[model samples]
Target: MPKSLHRRLLEKGWSEDEIERTMQMMYSDEKREKHAHFVSATHPVIYWVGLVVAIVGNLLVAVTLIPFLMILNSTQLYVILGIVGFVFGSMFNLIIKDIEHVDQTHHIVAGVFIPAIALITVYIMVSVANRFNEVINNPNPHNAIVLSAVYLITFSAPYFVYKIKDFVWERKQKASEGA
Candidate 1:
């Protein structure tokens, strides 16, 4: 069975009165039910748009970095894989949200998806750039290795941003609860 409206609201951080009113509306109006269905269908369009933006951004980053990298012939492979992964992540996020029970796992799934795609994209682009830099100056493998490590750290930028946003929202929820 579907979860009760009260439970869904509590999970969503809605006020008690808001929950009651929503539940009442759900029961009393067929129109409200239709609207809910519409919202449910369209809500993740925003996420899809975000994913598309991410894909485009990652592709741009890749294209920009490719020419600059003077490194070994293998840099192209990694860059291509990075682009593919981001595209897959975007499409996966869009498709998964359409399936039933997606609401139960949406946030965690999205949280993981965004960072994974962002990290892979960043790593590939930075790796190529680092190799390119090293190839022009020193033929040393050590520079490439160091660049990889630094690039991995940079790849985590999105995760930190996501965590901060989540923390702020949680704090707001607690403050609202206290008031």
Candidate 2:
């Protein structure tokens, strides 16, 4: 049989009274739920927002690389944005009070998603900048608007994929349960 948590704690030098108190505090239903909600809400919000900012920062770098190589040195701007995003995204782990409660699948999804989005964003931005250098160089209202729309769609693709995966998984789980 697996050792009880309290037993493990005791083996690790936790006093009996301390373990009892900690268990009681941890097992309190209301407190646990509230903590879970706080973690779930804050972790993903910070992570996704940070990811978007980082991707935009990467796109800015890509823009500088292709068409704006001579005209714009936006490396500093992107660096700052990247740093901020990294700090914010890393807070997902820091803000989590209980590691055991974290969904492993979500962590895995983020691990894959962040790098994939970053690479894709850089590629798309560089390709667009190269092809549409004229529009970028001589910016007009219509062209700017169209470019922005394209960027919006490109940046949101990862999120759309995640949602689709989640939807499919949920449907499968429901079907399995029903059967």
The per-prediction tally of clashing pairs is 1, 0
TM-score of 1: 0.44
Task: List the pairs of residues colliding in candidate 2.
Answer: none
Q: What are the per-residue Cα lDDT tens digits for candidate 1 across 93-117?
A: 4444443243646656655665566
Best by lDDT: 1
| Candidate 2 lDDT, 29-100, residue by residue in tens | 888898988878786666566556655655555555454422443454245434433443443323222231
lDDT of 1: 0.58
Query: In candidate 1, where is summed lDDT lowest over 10 consecutive residues?
Result: 140-149
The models' CA-based lDDT, in order, is 0.58, 0.55
| Candidate 1, position 44, lDDT | 75
